[model samples]
Target chain A: MENESFYDFGGPEPEPARPSIGRLSTVVANPTATGVEAVIEECAALSRSLDGILALIVATSDGMLIHSTWSEVEGMRAAAISAAALGLGQRIASDFGQGEFHDSVVSTGDRVIGIYAVGDRHVLGVVAAAEDVTLGLLHLSARRTAQAIGRVLSDS
Target chain B: MSEIDVINFKLVVTGPFAAGKTTFIGAVSEIPVVTTETGTSEGREVKDHTTVSMDFGKVSVADESQLIELYLFGTPGQSRFDFMWDILSKGMLGYVLLVDATRPETWTDAAAIKAKFDELGDVPLVVGVNRGTESDVDKVVAALRLDEAVPVLACEATDKESVKQVLITLLINVVEQLEATVKGSI
Candidate 1:
């Protein structure tokens, strides 16, 4: 049963005039690992393992692109959009008593957008073509990679 | 191709009600700004709508291989909705306290809000006086009892160049603060 007590939050807190450092820390945790470069390399390897993945990006929860398989402009755009989406998703889940938000997927006729939280301080955004892969396959493949990414972040 | 360093910084615009926070952001944002405005109370003739959340804009400064991405955020000016200000101002490098020169009555409230942010952190701040002249700027300085060194500029919220100038002024201060911080730490 959904708890109606979520409404007790008084009201929705507006987006801060600046990107939120607190929320960023909550969403992206510090990894135990010393080398974030190793994680970036892992992301590159993960991208290669998927046949349909067109673009893969790793970014800070605060919208800074850390690494990407796309060009600079595309990477920046994805990072910004992912940060906004993650913040809203987290709020909605909390407010509606949906428990902690895990990940989100947006599907259209042509492509799919996947956003997954990595540990606490990072987010992985993926763009894949519908023609080349099913959402089920994408999720399955992406979930395993998300776990690895989460571990990397958790340790870093 | 060579890689370029892209840095991101944040700046906030805040003040009392109907202080043109939304207008100022809309005037300068290169892309269609994101805003959260809700209907105002009935019989409020001055404004039918008021920003309940915030406004966001972006500007990019590119020099050679370095790119500085500046994000501008405008806060909801009502005292009742003041809780968001602290959240928004966090991690901000600097801010512009916009005051409506035409509304001298609102000056005290604006100063109070400014003082709150001033207490929040030691970031650089500038005063942007809207719908005011050079002389009105002096009045604002006096009302706020601001140090003579605080930068004050005549701001027209609808004028993009004026808004850009305000941002530039804040950016300069941010750089200076950063330099000072680095030097102190060393």
Candidate 2:
């Protein structure tokens, strides 16, 4: 079921630069094992609290996965790359001390998620299955997950 | 149009919190922009600021012999949030410091910023004083530390022609600097 979510979208959504959007739709309803316990618990809570799949991952700035949920397919190494891109974003933010970059979302092919800087060296990434999850909800959840990841990452 | 000659240089668009940096780039940008815009929190929540990181925009302009590309990265203008300037200023050709014309005191801050740009060592700078009104021109020019030589133009942040003027001045100054460098080298 990881790549078969073609017809489930809300009509015809525009494509995105990243293929993960459509890929997520296919695997969203897949049987996930709940990768990281604490994060998975938070994800479960938030997912039930809101409306979405809730893909979350914590990883090193260099793209090494530190922790993740069952939502990931490519797993650890892929998380690392996501962290690296988040790092690039942090570097950009650090370039101006514009303040530490928090989160970003790419909504395409019926996928809406925010990737954020969580800890000293880790990034917290999340995805929303339902396209209707408002920005307010997204930011709220992203902020909560970021704080959670910060605590989890600091210990590691 | 030779695909090999494309030089996409980056330009940072920066200003104070409500200074229209977002709208400025939006007005002139040729493509559908990608923005990381968050919502407003009135009194209960604090202002997280527009640019926690840099906002990027790309423009492609074509001519007979060449296609000049410009990439604009808008920086957050909070002075307290300047820890990133040291790295952001690296290899930059010039900067456009958008000053709010009504606030003359912001000129001292502008001087401080020019000093910051000067640290980049001979990088050119052009001042864009957002002058929505015609009467606000003189104070703005005087405040930006523009003598007779520098380019200090009044601009509406939402106007494309005004931005073009600021850009043209920077280009001319850069050309002059290159000429001077070649002459000194020779």
Which candidate should be chosen as best, given DockQ against the real structure? Answer: 1
Candidate 2 lDDT over A100-139, as tens digits, reads 7777676767677577776655566766665668877888
What is the alpha-carbon lDDT for the whole of candidate 2? 0.56
TM-score of chain A of 1: 0.72
Best by lDDT: 1
Best by TM-score: 1
**What's the count of clashing pairs in each model shown?**
14, 7
RMSD of candidate 1 to true structure, Å: 9.5
Pairs in steric clash, model 2: A53-A129, A63-A80, A63-A81, A64-A80, A95-B84, A96-B84, A97-B84
- List lDDT for all candidates, in order: 0.71, 0.56
lDDT (Cα, tens digit) per residue for candidate 1, span B1-186: 147665667777899888899999888876556667888994277788887766766777678886667777678898876656755564567889999999998899998998899986688898999999999999999999999878999899999999889888888888788889879999
Q: Which stretches in model 1 have alpha-carbon errors above 4 Å? A: A1-156, B1-5, B62-65
Candidate 2 Cα deviation (angstroms), residue B142: 2.2
> What's the lDDT for candidate 1?
0.71
